[model samples]
Target: MTGFAQLLDQLPLRFLLASAGCLAAGLGVWGATALLRRLPGVALQRSTWLLGQATVLACFLVILLPHSERLRLVPPIDVADMAPSRAAAPQGPTARPAVGGAPAAAVPGADPASWLTLVAQAWLLAYLLGFGHAVLRLLLARRMLDSLAATGSRLPCPGQPARAPVVIEVDAPISPMLFGLLKPRLLLPQHLRGFDAAQQQLIVEHELMHWRRRDLQWLSVGIVLQTLLWFNPFMRMLRSSLSWAQELGCDRDVLRSRSPAQRKAYAAALVAQLRLQHATPKTALAFGGVCASTLAARIALIREPSPAHPRRARVVRILAIAALACVFAASLAFQPALARRSAPTATQAPFSCTVMVDAASGEQLAREGHCDERVTPASTFNIPVALMGFDSGILKDARAPVLPFKTGYPSYNASWRADTDPSSWLQNSVLWYAQQVTTGLGAARFHEYVQRFDYGNRDVGGDPGKDNGTTQSWVGSSLRISPLEQVSFLRKVANRDLPLSAHAYDMTTRIMPKRTLANGWEVVGKTGTAPGLGRDGNDDATRQYGWYVGWAKKGQRTVVFARLVLDAKQESAMGGARAREAMLRQLTARLDVL
Candidate 1:
C-alpha cells in the first residue's frame, strides 16, 4: 500500500491522464465494434452501424465546438443580519452623507481581463488540436492511395459484379488489392496471376467486409487522433485499439453471410494473401492479410460461432464501459489547482530562495532556477536540523540558551570557550553548537524526526567522514545536503507544521539576521563554514566549506535560495556570503520592475 502511494505520487500528471484517456478511447471503440457484431441482418446491421457512427461523430463535434460565452456571476449572500432594507436594495436612496456630510462611492465590479485571457488560451489550444487531427487524416488517406498505386493494382469499375472482368494479364505482375472508399485501391506487383474462382470470391468478400463497415475511414480518423496527440501514450494505445476494433468489425461482417466452412476458407485466403504480399507497404491496406495475431483471431472466430460467448462478451463490454465512465467522470469532476492553492498573483508578496507555492488554490507559480542544474548543499542543512529541534522536545525554545564551551580535537590546544549560545551560534552557523544540539536530542529522538522528513539519508549520528558528511574543524563531521532539499526544508519550516511551537517558530524566524540592501527591503539568511572534503589542501589541514540560505519576501514574490562554496581553504570558506549577495542582486533587479 505504501509503495503504491509512492508510485502514484511520483507519476507525472500528463502520464496519468493520458493513460486514462487511452483506456477510455480503446474501450469506446471496442464496445462499439462488439455491439455492431451482435446485430442481425447484413443490410440492416450495416445501416445501424453507419447511423450509430454518424451519431457518435456528431456528439464528438459538439464537444469540440466552443461553449457558450457567458459571464459567471458571484452568488449573492443572504446575510440576514446585514441585509439592506428592501427599499434601498433596488434603488438609490437620497445621497447618503458621510461624517462630514459627503456622499460615499459604491464599489464597482472587478476587471475581467485575466479571466478573458485564460478563456482565449483554452479556446486556442482546443482549436489547434482539432484542426491538427483533421490535417493528419487527409495525409493518411493520400499516403494510403499512393501505397496502393505503387503495388500496381487497378480498381474495378464501380457497380460491377464482385468478380467481373477478372483478367490475368501477362503484361502485368499480379499484386494484392483492397477495396474501400476514401482512396480505395489495390496492391499487385509486376508478375502474379489471378486466384481461382473460389479464392477470388473469398478475397473480394474480405475487402467488401472493410467497405461495408467503412472500417478504413474509422482507421484513418483514429490514426489522425493518434498522430496529433503523439506525446500521449494513451493516444498510442488508441491506434492499436482502433485497429483491433476495425479488424474485429470486418471479421463479424464477413461472418454474417458465410457458412462456417466458407469462413475458414476466407481466413485461409487471408493468411495466403499475407504470405504472398510479404512486402506490404505501410501506406496501403491489404485486404488479403494482416498481423499474425489478427489472422489467428480471425481463424479462431471461424472455428467458434461465438469466439467471445454472448454472456462473456456482455460482461467485457460492461466492464470496459464502467471503467471508462469512471475515468471520465473522475477527470471531469476535478477542480483546478487541487494539489496546492493557486499561487499568489505577481502582485502578492514574494519569498526569498523563493518557493512559489499557491497558498490559496495550490497552483505553483512559475519561477526561475527550476531548470538550473542541481548542486550539493552545505550548511543550508541546518534548516532541517532546526526543524528536527522544533519537532522534538530537545533544543525546545528558540529563546532558551544552551551556551556550551569547546574542548574538541580542532580546539584541543586552545583554552575552552564557554560563551556558546544556541540562538547566537545558530545565527552565526557555529558548527560546535549544531553538534551539541544533535547530541542533546539523543539518537532515538533524532531518528524519529529524520524518519518523519524522509530526507533520503539514514545516518543516525554517525561520524561525518564515514557517512555522507565531510570532516570539519569545529564539528567533527557534517552531513551533505542538496540545494533542492534546502528549499524543501524551508517550505516545511515556513508552513510551521514541523516540531516547533508557534511562538518559538515566530521568534526564530524573527531573530534570524537579515542583510539590508540599498533599498528598504531586507533579506534574512543563515551562513555556515566547515572543513571541506576529497581533493583538499595538503593532509586536509586547510579544507573548508561554506553555505548560506534563506528566504526574501518582496511584493508578491517570496524567493528562497541556497548558496554553497564547496572544498575551499581558510577564509575562502566564507565565499558563500558574497555569492548570496550577487544572486540576490540579479533576482531583485528582475522583481523590481514587476
Candidate 2:
C-alpha cells in the first residue's frame, strides 16, 4: 500500500489512543472541579481549558510518533497460526525439499495484521470523510463570522477614548461580543449604545478581560480540535465547558473589586445582551452567547459570588496538577502502535550472524548480530566452486558427467558414498565432487576468480605452501568470507550483476536445493559445516562451525540471506543442516522464508 493509505489505516488506532487521553484528562479536571464545588472561577477555568488542551495534545502526540512496520498493535499472521487445510507435515531437517500444498488458511480471521497491507484501511476512509465534513463546516462558519464583522462600524465607542479597541456598533440584534484576532475589537448592538457610560464601562471591561486572557486563541484551538477529532464526543463536551468557564471567569474578573451597586449594573447588562445569539460562529468567543438559562445562572453568580475558599482551592489545584500528569502519562502510554523488531536470537552457539538484503535496492532487509566477522567458508564454498566449474566448461548440467566418489574421500555422510552429479553433490554434500571441480580450476585461476568476486580475503595460496590451495583453502583453512559478503555475493548473482556466464548462472540456480513453502514461496540455499573453521580465536574442533547461505523468491522479488553459527560443542545434527532448518523457521515466521 502507499504511505498515505498506511497512515489512513492507522487513524482508527490513533483516534482510540487519543480517546484514552481525553478520558483521563476529563476525569482529572472534571473530577477535581466536582470535588471542589466552589473553586475560584478563574482557577477552575484554567484547569478546564487545560483539560481540553490535554486531549488534543495527546492526539497530536500520537500522530507525530514514527510509524512501525514490523511491530504494530496487530501482529502479522504466521503459518503456524493458520487453520489447517490438510494433514500436518512431518517436522524435521529430513523433510523433502519441494513438498507443496496450501497446508493452512487464515485461521478463520484470527489474525488482523497484513503482511504488506493494513487491516484498518476502511476505518481510515470513514474518518477522513467525517473529518473533511467537519472542516468544511468550520470554514463556512468562519466565512459567516467575517461577513458579520464587516456589517459594523469600525469607530471607537462614543465616550471611550480614540485609543481603545475598535468598537463596532452593529444594527444587528446580537449580544455585545469580543471579536477580531490580529486587532482586537469590541462589538456592541445599536440598542446598547444608549446605556449610561458606567454600564458601558462594565461591558467593555468584560470583553477586554477575554482579550487580555487570550481567550480567542484558546477558542481557535477548540475549533481546530473539533475539526480534527470530529467524532470524539468528549471534545464537544470540552469545547462547551471551556466557553462556559471563560465567560464565568471573565464575569468574576470584571466584578472582582467593584461595589455591590456596580455588580448589580453588570448583572443587568448581561440580561439585556440576551436578545438573540444566532448568526454567531462557533469559532468566536462571543460575550453575548448566554441563553436565558445561562443568563439566570450568570445573574445568580453575580448577586452572590463564590466566597473565597483558599484551602479548598489550593487542594483542588494540586489535584488538577496531578491529574494533568496522569493524563500525559496515559496519552504517551497509549500510542497507537509500537515497532516489534526481531529480537536478538538466543542460541547455544557462541557466535552467530545472519544478514539478508533486498536484491533491487540493496537495502538491508533483516539482520541479527553484526555480520562483518569473517571465517572459513567450509563446504559453503562449493557453490562458488560449482559456478566456476560451469563458467570454465569443466562441469556440464545438473545431472551430467557423473564423477565417482574416491575411496579416501571424506564420506562422513553415508549419502555421499555413491557417484555424484551437481544435484546430489550439493544435496549429499559430497566433498570429493567439490574438490574435483576446484582442482580442475587450479590455484591461480581459482584465486583470480575469488579476487575478482571480492569473496573474503581471496588468499587461496593454501596454509603456507602446503600446495593444497585448490582442495583445502575453504576447508577450515585460509579462504574466509563473512555473512555480509555472502549475502552481497548472492544478491549480485540474482541481479545478474556478477561477471559469471549466463550458462553458469543458469546451472548454479538449477542445482541449488530449494524448499517450497505452503504460501508458494521457494527457498533455495546451501549449507556448509566444518570443525575448527576459525582462523584466529575459534579454532577448536569440538566447536562445530556452520553456515547456511542462499535466497528465497516469490515472483520477481527476491531476498538473499546468509547465516553463520558457531556452536560450543558438536550437535547430533550436522551444524550446517541444523542452521538451515532453524533459519527456515525464523524466516517462515516473517512469511519471507529465505
lDDT (CA) per prediction: 0.44, 0.66
Tens-digit per-residue lDDT, 214-250, candidate 1: 6667656555555544444444444554555555566
lDDT of 2 by residue, 30-128 (tens): 554454445454434556554545655564555344432221223221111111211123222343322221112222333333322232344556768
Work out how many backbone clashes candidate 1 has.
Answer: 41
All candidates: TM-score:
0.35, 0.51
lDDT of 1: 0.44
Per-residue error at 87 for model 2, in Å?
21
